[model samples]
Target: MNEYQKFREQIDEFMQHHPQSPLDEAHRLYFRGLFYYEPSPAYLVMATVTRFSAREPLVEMETSTGDRRRYRRWGRAHFTIDGEAAALTIYANPYEEDFFLPFRDATSGKETYGAGRYLDSHRPGLRQLGEGEIGIDFNWCYNPYCAYNEGYSCPLPPRENWLAIPIRAGEKVFHSSSR
Candidate 1:
């Protein structure tokens, strides 16, 4: 198998042991729709971010309720997508000091979740790889803090993070027939 395949295998094994991850029960259920710890066809994207930034904290994401809520944007970074080059952002907000991402794309509401998917990009995994680089494995992209349950504030994806192309990489929308 190739290197990417090997990495995916490791991820699958990890997921089985840590299913639902560090997220709550609801969040874990939401993530299960997008990923599982088993061998199957998975999308492994190797992309780089062109423009990157790290916000001190305090970011916002508009909600379906028509409210603009602010959350901590501690672990923010920008990168490219499939060599196309884009600025990807991540929110460092885990259950207990975690990082997250909530974004929208052209496919939002149509192809994928209207609010976009969530990615748990913890720092330790890539620290050994070096700086200004990240591997946004769609297999890991699930839903944001809000998708699972209520009362939790989440950092929405900025307008810039919206991808015009359909990722078709990670978990698809829960209610969509396409999924």
Candidate 2:
């Protein structure tokens, strides 16, 4: 198997066997596997991250539990997928080394998790931002823990990251036995 396929398999194994998996014990009994689109080249994008002149106003994104978390609009990643132009807003919290991207596309509430998925650009990925480009593999996007278990509190994707196009990649809506 190729790297992406291997990675997907590893994730599936973790979700099925790991104690910290989002799937609850009862749900794990019936867990088949996560749904995913075929690994499409169109969804693997290289983006140019253009930093903001200054940090944008802090937005308090509400969580699944009705609590809120503060995040600042750090920058934007501009790229194209399947000849369609698109962009995603990056958010950062104070004292964080990695940047967070919570986004929702047309697939939300249907094929994917309704609240949205998250991507984290780690320190190495952040370093590329200074170089004007960062790899954005939508194949790595994953549903929040709240999708599998209600006990989790996940931040909702801000309005800015909602895309009009369907992103047919990454984790799909979890069809748990409990749900």
Candidate 3:
């Protein structure tokens, strides 16, 4: 199989037993407004991430939940968007064994949500990708459950993940959250 195909297979395998698979649930479509530095057409990216690491093999990690969940590490990754190549860095929580992407692009406090947003990379199968070189796709970027719920202490994005450019992707800022 090709690289993307391989990646898809890994993602599918991960969702099978992941804590937030949403399996058997009805599909819900939410509209997210993404803005680019300049006026550029928006592209459709999967907008997700998977976990990876040798010490912690399962993409899943322990969280506030009684059971464990999945997460992705922030490492080195390469992507080509609209034929332009970009490199990114991600972060990992050793204690929680969670991988998260907390980023603040030019959109901070502007077109998109401010205080940065996050993506959960908790796919066990895809976790392997991060174990090595550790570069990943920003397409899966998402908002922590805290964006919608008030009882969770989702890890906030670190200052290092903040990018100077406009991400124009993923979930928007939760206007109600103190973050």
All candidates: CA RMSD (Å):
6.8, 2.7, 10.1
Of the pair 1 and 2, which is ahead by lDDT? 2
lDDT of 1 by residue, 45-107 (tens): 434433323445465667645577665554444544445545556555423445555666655
Residue 17 error for model 2, in Å? 1.8
Residues 50-114, candidate 2, lDDT per residue (tens digit)? 87755456779999999999887777899898788999988887557468889999999999999
Worst 10 residues of 1 by lDDT: 123-132
Q: Per-residue lDDT for 39 in model 3?
A: 21
Give one digit per residue, the lDDT tens place, for model 3 in 1-179. Answer: 65434554454454344456433222112212222222222523222233235454434433333345544454544445555555444556556646555566776677655545655557321243423444344444555554444456555454445566566654445443122
Instruction: Report, for every candidate in turn, its global Cα lDDT versus the true structure.
Output: 0.51, 0.81, 0.46
Which residue runs of candidate 3 sit more than 4 Å off their true CA positions?
1-74, 78-88, 95-97, 123-135, 149-151, 173-179
- Candidate 1 vs candidate 2: which has greater TM-score? 2
Report clash pairs, candidate 2.
none
